[model samples]
Target: MDFAGTDAAEKATYSTLTALMYRACEPIDDDTSVLARVVGCSVRTFKKSLEQLIRKKLILQLENGNLWSVQIEEELKNCNENLNRLSERAIKAANTKRNKQKDNSSREHDEVMTTSSRGHDNIMMSSSRQHINNNIYNKKLKLSF
Candidate 1:
């Protein structure tokens, strides 16, 4: 939930972590640069996830600086599910905000048009004698943005 990093939570980090977990059954090299490439993220990004895994006690860092899992394989399995849920919720919230703004703008526009129409009707109601008084008076249509 609080996956904040200085710049970004960086989905790449999560992805790299998942890759590391899946491959935990394999022997770990002291360096994770090769696995980092396989996960399609930078070594720095992969390192961050590895650090998090250690911090969360989901993984243990050996004295030799190699990585090992701590019964977190099942948790790693849900990474994709978590990412999907997060994406869906974010999109839904964004769409809801957009729709609310559209509805508000439409209501404002309708109010302005209704006021204009009412003003036109009022003018017509009293203007027959005025039209006879002023031959030069003409109704001008207003355009609104």
Candidate 2:
């Protein structure tokens, strides 16, 4: 998969999703040091990035805990599934386009070969006619002799 092909929204969503999962492994309370740590995010920039994930609903707080449950993992999985499908489609489209271009190139090559063969045939025919004409002239000269 080409990284360049990934859209900004998708990339953002992927990272946010990962943050939710990482934080999920920790405790879920606001007072928990894990919250501060996750919120602090030295791990994959989740420090400040955690708040961003919460705001996006990609991460959620369990009603009253200091531990996060990775509330958005399933959703992120679905999104990732969709993204995978899209990537597959784009790759298939590119392959089809390449195949079509190859077919067109081969067709053009065949036409060129046919055209060259016809030109060679014409040259041969013209030379044959000139040879016949010379022969006729020679016969006339001999008869006159």
Candidate 3:
């Protein structure tokens, strides 16, 4: 529905092709020459327009020169499907990245906590050893006296 990326020429060609396609689909004969006359464009320009439409995948050119609009529907469907697939993939990738970051942060926190506890244990051991040495020195002084 949104032709944001398409150019003016392409839009014109598409509009013309839609008209041609509608006429082609009718029960009457699908005459390109008459269609060209009705569109007020030279037959050569009409052929170019048809080629442009086909190149853009907005129309389908049959072997018998009867154009069809089948590709228009198919292309839109394909675009929507591809967009959905890409969107899902992007979401999955973001989630994976987020989870990895959370895990890394958790591991970092755990390592910091372990290091902090180890430091506290070392301080406690040092203070206890100093207390025991002082007690032994005091006992020796009493014995010598």
Candidate 4:
């Protein structure tokens, strides 16, 4: 699956934090140093990762460095799924619209061709009738021998 945000290292750190949240049933109220030791990261790195998770809405930091709401991961997953579904629907709608436009254009072209063919046929018939009339008039002409 595609991950949101920066590189693999950040993602790995985020995963570690999530694992820590999941493993612990209740909210954690430990110091940053202890948390860093638990996640095997430097204290500064742990603090930065925690901030990133909060910024990304993947975790909620409560009062006094307490963290809660591990269900945020599930929520994020659901949101991503919905977004993908909506994107697919939008693509289908656009394709359907394009097809309808193509069909309408083809129908309009066919109608114009049919009308032009009828007009050409009418002109040919009128010219033929005039020619026949001239032939009859020539045959009726009188000449002295």
Per-candidate TM-score against the hidden true structure: 0.39, 0.48, 0.44, 0.44
Best candidate per lDDT, number?
4
Tens digits of lDDT, candidate 3, 1-145:
4567665555665676676555444322347687567666767776676676667666776676666677555655687799999999999999999999999999999999999999999999999999999898888434554
Model 1 over residues 83-123: C-alpha lDDT tens digits?
Answer: 89999999999999999999999999999999999999899
Q: Write the per-residue lDDT of candidate 4 for residues 35-114, one digit (tens) a residue.
A: 78777778888778777767776668877667765575575568779999999999999999999999999999999999
The parts of candidate 2 lying over 4 Å away from their true place are 1-68, 138-145
Question: Candidate 2, residues 94-134: lDDT per residue as tens digits?
Answer: 99999999999999999999999999999999999999999
Q: What number of clashing residue pairs does each candidate have, in the order they appear?
A: 0, 13, 0, 0
Local accuracy by lDDT, each model: 0.68, 0.60, 0.71, 0.75
Off by over 4 Å in 4: 1-76, 139-145
* Candidate with maximal TM-score: 2
